[model samples]
Target: MDTPSSSARVCGERPFYDLHAEAYDLIINDPVKPWCDAVDAQLARSSSILDAGCGTGRHAAEMIARGHVVDLADAAPRLLAQAAARCPSARTQLIDICLLPTADHDAVMCRGVLNDMVSDGERAAAIASLARSLRAGGKLFLDVREAEASRERADGEPRTRSGFTSRTTWDNGLLRVRETYAMGGDVVEYQFTMRPWSVGSLTGLLRDNGLRNVSVGGGVGRRTPDRLFVVAF
Candidate 1:
């Protein structure tokens, strides 16, 4: 039987992260080696990196260990706190990607964040903000869900990990997800929406934001099936 406290309610991305912060690392612990390898291959030695939308600072911590200067930024305070705790040496900012500083880093790695921008205007603004965060000739690395593949897999059975159970459904162009965490006598639930990206549409957005030399490839690590790893300069 389900917990009596279980309730369904819509939530935005920030609130979802804030609620999920404590369980995030355990639930979403995919290996970071592949992504770090990609970054190493593309960036200069000892490059300064901005881990935009960084959740728990896993990537930033790894990048710092590999001799790169990494700063973390995210809109969710709870998530950012966890990130800072994980990477105490790295600088952190509590700000959205759309308001990131201009020309500040040698490269920016934004993983699993773009899909949350459900509107074209929000997507455009985000890309533009990321572009502005780059120094001249700097690169941008993005990991996002591929629309077709994600939609095809959206209706899969519920997945439980780290005391959380998650189910997803694709409707129209949105991927709606519900996550429930039940531990001891307490239960928490969150629902959120995401809009995946197609190659052509994403490419056009990058170009419009003055980000050229776009390359889209298969996902890194465990995300290979339904995600796209994109690189732009």
Candidate 2:
């Protein structure tokens, strides 16, 4: 494990992903079958789908196998590369969700990405961008951590997985996460902050971005207890 330099440490989001990309699947491993089931239930056959912020392309690969046209996009280059490798038939772009193309997809699926937008302005821009990326009648499927549930679980316990140990703490409205990777004789640490969303605030944001007919449910798959899954068109 090699630690990031001081400059890399300054920007937590990108650096954390860069360092964790190789072990991301192992550390954050959760079943994608339930998510695919949710997508199948909502989206029509052969729909053009954009897996915005698609980390490692697990869901996008499943969508492609299910006869959908899938595109993978992520701000992190390493993550995007991994996703592209997993889904060679899908177009891959190293772009942020806020900078995605408009009206280019029949549906957009963004999972666990909105929480990374710590500021209100960033969150608004990202959601508006997702809405703009859809064609008329296109749907947006997204999920974020529920504020209360996340707070309850943010006990700062050090949990180890795939040779990485992580701890999370809740502060006001933000989650302070710290991770350490141990390998050989080296130990590397990374830290970042995430903001959970309230139902009222998230619903209002979706409606404000011109997305209508919002449907909110429990988190998909293993995330049901601590997350909120939403669909809007």
Candidate 3:
């Protein structure tokens, strides 16, 4: 298996989560209740859950609230600190998803994180690591956007939030997103590059990593039509 080097090579060791840790919770206010409900339906009350790549403990908070033993892990330390603050009772750690510590979990969730890995090797390593973190019958839950739809939407127009303006374009067959933050005349620029995945490709990749019983469905709770929600055992 290959070690994950995309974060370092493309956007430093911690990537966007660490860079924007302070603004993450504020910027990402999308209601996670529905997504949590969907995942909750798949898990037992006492399941040992590992929220791998959990950013600021959104899902972890829900699981912990439901009386599950949830461990929150992320590659970004600042983000992990935020997760720790949000869910003080649950264990929080700074961990790379592609190099997770060996532990038997009843279910492991890698939500909205795998696409951050810019290369196939990094994505593969992350999946394999998730497999290793699971117990014999443990299941894995993940969600990602459809490549074609993402490309079309991104290329369609520019968008802005707060003081940040972003536009997506194609570069060398990869999606390149350029974001500029206006900070009182001093503008800061950031770029993110990602490769999109199809449902078939994602399902195959999970199975290739020894994750069986793979299934893909509409995005969690059917809120997002363009997203692909994946479940595997």
Best by TM-score: 2
Better model by TM-score: candidate 2 vs candidate 3: 2
Residue pairs of candidate 2 with colliding backbone atoms: none
TM-score of each prediction: 0.91, 0.91, 0.89
Runs off by more than 4 Å, candidate 1: 1-16
- Give the 10-residue window scoring lowest on summed lDDT in candidate 3: 7-16
Q: Output the number of the lDDT-best candidate.
A: 2
Candidate 2, residues 1-233: lDDT per residue as tens digits?
03332212332354346765677787667898898999888888999999998888999999999999999988777878899999999998777677677766889999988888777777777888899999988999997899999999999999886788889999998999998888555678878788899988998998998886898889988733889889998
Ranking by lDDT: 2, 1, 3
Q: What clash count does candidate 1 reach?
A: 0
Q: Rate the local accuracy (lDDT) of all candidates.
A: 0.81, 0.82, 0.76
lDDT of 3 by residue, 1-233 (tens): 35445643432332336555576766566678877888789988888999987788988898888888999887777778888999998887676678887789999987767777767778777788889899988999987767877777677367877666778876654678787766455567887777767777778878897887998877774444657788899
Is candidate 1 or 2 superior in TM-score?
2
TM-score, cand. 1 vs. native: 0.91
Comparing 1 and 2 on lDDT, the stronger one: 2
